[model samples]
Target: MSEKSGHSEKKTSLFGNEYIQHYDKDGNKCGTSEEKTTLFGQTYTQHYSENGDKCGISEEKTSFLETKHYTQFYDKDGNKTGTSEPKESFLRGKYIQHFNEEHEKIGYSENKKSILGTKFRQHHGAHPRDESKKKIVQTSASNNDSGDGTSASNTSSSGKNFILWHVFAGLFLILTYFFWQQWLNKQAKEAEEKWKNEVKIIASKVPGKWLGHASNTVVTLYLTHLYGDRFSAKVNFRGSDQELQMDFGKGNYSTSLFLTSRLHAPLYFPITIPAYNKNGVVLIFRGKFANNGKRDVFCGQLIFDQNWKILGSFQDSDGSVGYWSVGECDGMPSNISGNWEGKWERGGLWNPLEVNQTRFKLSLKQEGKVFVGKVSYIGSRGSSSLRGEICGDYINFKYRYGDGVVREYVGQAAGDHISGTWSQNNSFGTWTVSRK
Candidate 1:
């Protein structure tokens, strides 16, 4: 989980004790340190030389309030070498002051906590009298390009500190990269979830019974099966006198998603239904959501010809310019008169639970809110008496069968459609009819 140690360093945890063996850059075993914590919560780290002789010790302690902590160091033979302690300044912020064995202030290091990680800028020098000498050394080191990497005046101890500083700097960069990658991955996942939710919302509007008229041509579009920008729909093309066929388009009639790029445009959508005519004319519905009195409707025109120029009307290959709009969906319809038809279902012989369909049709003649209709079973070729009254979008009536059984029909009329339940005492069935 961390990479603060050198490649040549080996860590050992024995009997819950923290033991570490240090190694030089050349892979030579240099020294070792063993840290032990007493029951009183005091930690002592014993340092050893390459020859397995005791060299120094580091003692760490914390105040009772835990607001302050200190670590003191000792040399071989138990002599104080230095101490690194923290100091706070309102103007300068918090920093660590380093001292030599003589207990004289040598230098200070500033510790900054950032979003990336903790960073340190440490400066070390001799007494004020040796300031001139320090400048001369720095000038010489910068000028001598042929000089060895190490400074001539610095002791072996300083050399060790120099290597350790670079090691920590490298580790800092690595830590930053690790954190950045984590942030990037999190953002990508969030964007993906957002895209999925947007698809669902837009898809919900797609699946519905949409009816629109363009001149004498009547279009009934059934959008269904929406998932991730893709959906299936059946386009029923009919004239003013033509009945809704449910299936009229030739070939695959499907189109790929251009939604991501077009979603932001003023044109909310453009669905291309292909292979409509002998010349392979593609009809694209370019539209937006419109309030159709009692409900939301998808009102737009079917752009013909070239795919790119979808902004306005175009001449279709069928010799006439095209336009269409959906005036009804999920809610009540304004008009209930037309050729309305659906299926009558009952339990089948093979499976008692499975419902089977029988074609039921109604030709309604509406005057104001009341309507008298002719109900016909397709195979029988015989018509029956049907009368229904419309209240808002609801229609209910009584159908007298040929055998004198009167079934009550209660249907909800929404957007040129009526569908409800029919019942006769213990017998019941569902009836749904769509306006042609």
Candidate 2:
């Protein structure tokens, strides 16, 4: 049947004259034949059967001021049955080759020119010796010429070699990737350990309260020891940022206070100078951590005017300087002294019981910065005495809950509410209290 577009599908073309057509559900080419033009002005037309099998192709080319034509033919099953081209010398004599239903070449026709005249002679049952057939026949003869044992042995040895090479390559790559990951992990661990060491060495040296006294206000400093050598210090004062004038003071304020056999350079800690000042004296605290049987000391220095002055200078008890102890301040005026609605949770890692949530009543009294409280379950299980201390926003309390079990409460205070974790007998849970 002549081809026509079907199923509302249109032919698609990459270029003006070239088209790529798709097939229908039954694998039938349901569109017009495609034509392609080459850059050299060569045109190729492909014709497909209704079954979507390419049945024929025609190529036209112009070379050396002459036009050439080439055509190829295919069977209904899309097998190349024959071709018509004068340029191929081999096909000039054998113009056509006939094949059986199985596509095995069975015969061919050759045009011969003898003394009589040019005539076509048909040779039947004479197959063509193509490249594929040559390789098959040669391989069969080679395997047969040698003993069967030798041939099989060679094949087996070659396969074993190929498999061994691939196995070794794969294992090598896996080991390389594993070692690379291990190296990365080792680097990270070393960096963390180094940081911890630095922090620890810094903390041990500067272990006291630092103070800066100006004429109007006193700047209190508290250094909280943290993991490694890292520490967080709280500076308590109220004024414009420029009012707190500070200087590192005079002398080498860094010294090693611990015993270590190795001789190492002193490690300096970071200290920011305050802008607040009393009169014209600027005060600052400075210190350095020490290693290897050395002691590290921090001292306060007061500079009179902009130059170093001996009048306002102060230092830690390093024989020539004086120091003061830092004190805690009551957080806010809002005292947590009233009845509160409380929740008590009973499970922690140390407790064997399933976690339970219960309600309780808490009575608290605050005296200065100290907290004394009692908590009782709703069913009157008897209340326990509580004692704790509040530091800034942090509150910590502990109570004995009858059975020799001590419950500790640590949390932050938020106005009228307190929320924190509670731990008892190695078990821990959270609690919340709101003013009632």
Candidate 3:
């Protein structure tokens, strides 16, 4: 039955030191042959029986020198029986133990004590009372011994206190915001009240009325060195309603007169008297003054006011001795205050010829009782200038022509229209004026 006699299969040991060869009944190598060995530095060998059953295993310390192999034998129960060779090595500076099939150490030797002995023992489940476990147990015991439960109770109390403090802080902030808003509203109301009081005080300081007079009149009597007598009339005004009224008596009148012309004659002349708050006076007066067989209409306006009294009057007619001591209407000419355009009869009936049509334009301005203006004449003789004055609605102006002849004119102004008469001299027939 020796394998070498070819009656049994020859097999190699797993450690590569032995081989087995199978044979047939004729004692020749037959069937399949197998070789098994440990790979690399594996120092352990496991063995099986002919029936492909795991039987036993052997562990050996391998060396480089002696090519000795370890063998394992098993009974029917697959337990190791014996071992053949053992190995040792000093190069690794450590010793190893070889084990039998039953996991019992067959030979034991020490190589070196492990530096990570506790870790190794822990991995192998051999460490007693590990440090992490010990700390956990101690902590559990300490928690159990605190009889008042102070740690947990303190933490819960602190959490409740935090919630209460946060609520109180939020309420305080809300109350502060409301109080600030109330203060702002109070300040705004106070400011508005202050502004209203100031305005009321300022309104109380203005004056109630203006100063001026209602009307004034002036009359002058002149006696000639020979036998003639003359009467001069002038009016002064504060405003339109405040005026001076003059009444002339019967006398030989040769002195100049000025009148304020009116636009239209009213049924009754308006005599306005200025009051404190009532309508202010407009100095207007119209009447008739006679000389020789002709009657001339007189109109005048009061142009100045002083201390609520009429001080100056302006007559819108031509006159000499214009500036008097009462209030000088110096160099005043009677002319309507408006725009005027009109045509006049050109020539006289002597030659039965009408040539060189006459066109006239006049404007007057008044300051208080005094007035100044200009008149333009457009005719075949070209254009000329005349001085003018304002007295109510009556206007008079005169200009000297190149022929050394003086022409006098009278006109009236109302609203946007004016009309008047022109005389070549004081005795010539009158030329009519109509607003264009």
lDDT scores for all predictions? 0.45, 0.42, 0.33
Q: Tens digit of lDDT per residue, candidate 1, span 1-436?
A: 1122121122446566434454433445666655544433433555666677766655543559987555455554454566555576887665545556566776544433335542222223431112222111110111111022211111112222333466787789999999999999999899778656644654555467766643346667666744464555555543211111112133344332221111132223324454444222334332222122111112122322211111112122222333333443223335677798787554321123767677788988888767898888877968887876654454556667677766556555556666554444334345677776
Best model per TM-score: 2
For 162-225, candidate 3 gives per-residue lDDT tens digits of: 3346678778999999999999999999976754453343223211232322222343321112
As a whole number from 0 to 100, the lDDT of residue 293 in candidate 3 is 30
RMSD of 1: 22.6
Return the lDDT, model 3, position 30: 34
Put down candidate 2 lDDT per residue, 1-436, tens digits, no spaces: 1122111122335564533343333445443344544333333444444455554433322236556322333332334433322222443432334333344544433333335542212222332222122110000001111111111111101112233466787789999999999999999899777645543544554445655443235756555665543344444432312112122322223222221112454244333333323323233333433323434233333222322121121221222222222333333534788899978676422132667788888898988778798888787668888886655554666667667666556555678887755544324466788989
Candidate 3 runs further than 4 Å off = 1-339, 346-357, 363-373, 379-382, 431-436
Once fitted onto the true fold, the runs of candidate 1 whose alpha carbons sit more than 4 angstroms away are 1-158, 238-314, 327-436
lDDT of 3: 0.33
**Candidate 1 displacement at residue 85 in angstroms:** 34
Please report, as a residue range, the 10-residue window in candidate 2 with the lowest summed lDDT: 135-144
